[model samples]
Target: MVKKIEVEGYNALIECLKENNTGTVFVHFSGSLDENGVNWCPDCVKADPVIARNVDKAPEDSIFIHCHVGPKAYWKDQNNDFRQDPKFYLRCVPTLLRIGSPQRLQEDQCCSDDLVQMMLEETEENVTPRY
Candidate 1:
């Protein structure tokens, strides 16, 4: 079963993953660029803490996704039209999974379609859900 959902910024995304879980976890990071500190739509990050500690917290073989959309997302601080210091772009996912790698992220195709594709892939060879 898939558990947990989030609408977090790049920083929040990482902090969330640090939590514990034993089930398949599905996260939807914003793929569209907002005007502030938000980037839940940039990319999908997966790994098992044990094997990759980034995906699910299952016994061994598990799936998990860490996502981010773009830089300067969310309600911008000080209402500055989402304008931010270019240096900060590296602090978040520039486009998708290229967290701290704005240039690379911008060149990548990290969008809703990516999320759908990933979900579809997981569904295709998915194990028997414990639901």
Candidate 2:
């Protein structure tokens, strides 16, 4: 079974990553939620179901981290930690990335079931080597 973790903010995400860095790790960065449990980003809202459905494509021991990147104002700031952090350097919400690898899907890409499954099932041998 895949291990799933939900974290809010950059600090929480960093802490979670420190503890669970090994194995097949996937990080999903999305917008923060309100009291109603609804995310501020429409794209994130749309991509959630697609990602959830494709989770089974990953290995059983894989780790899935769902990171909420705070409110719209926070995410729009140029100094947002998620964007500045070299490990992520996120350009948009609803980003699905394979840790320790170059594989990633952003924005509308995350809403595509086909792309999400492809990323989840991709292996190290399938990754294109970086020059």
Residue-pair clashes per candidate? 27, 0
* Candidate whose lDDT is highest: 2
Write candidate 2's Cα lDDT for 1-131 as tens digits: 99999999999999999999888899999999988989999999999989988988988899999999999999999899999987787999999998777789999999999999999988877877433
lDDT of 2 at 4: 94
RMSD of each: 11.9, 1.3
CA error at residue 73 for candidate 2, angstroms: 0.7
- Give one digit per residue, the lDDT tens place, for model 1 in 35-125: 6633233232321111123233322333334344334335334432222434233333323221122222222333344433443234323
Q: How many clashes would you count in candidate 1? A: 27
Which ranges of candidate 1 are over 4 A from the true structure?
31-131
In model 2, the clashing pairs are none
Q: How many times do residue backbones clash in model 2?
A: 0
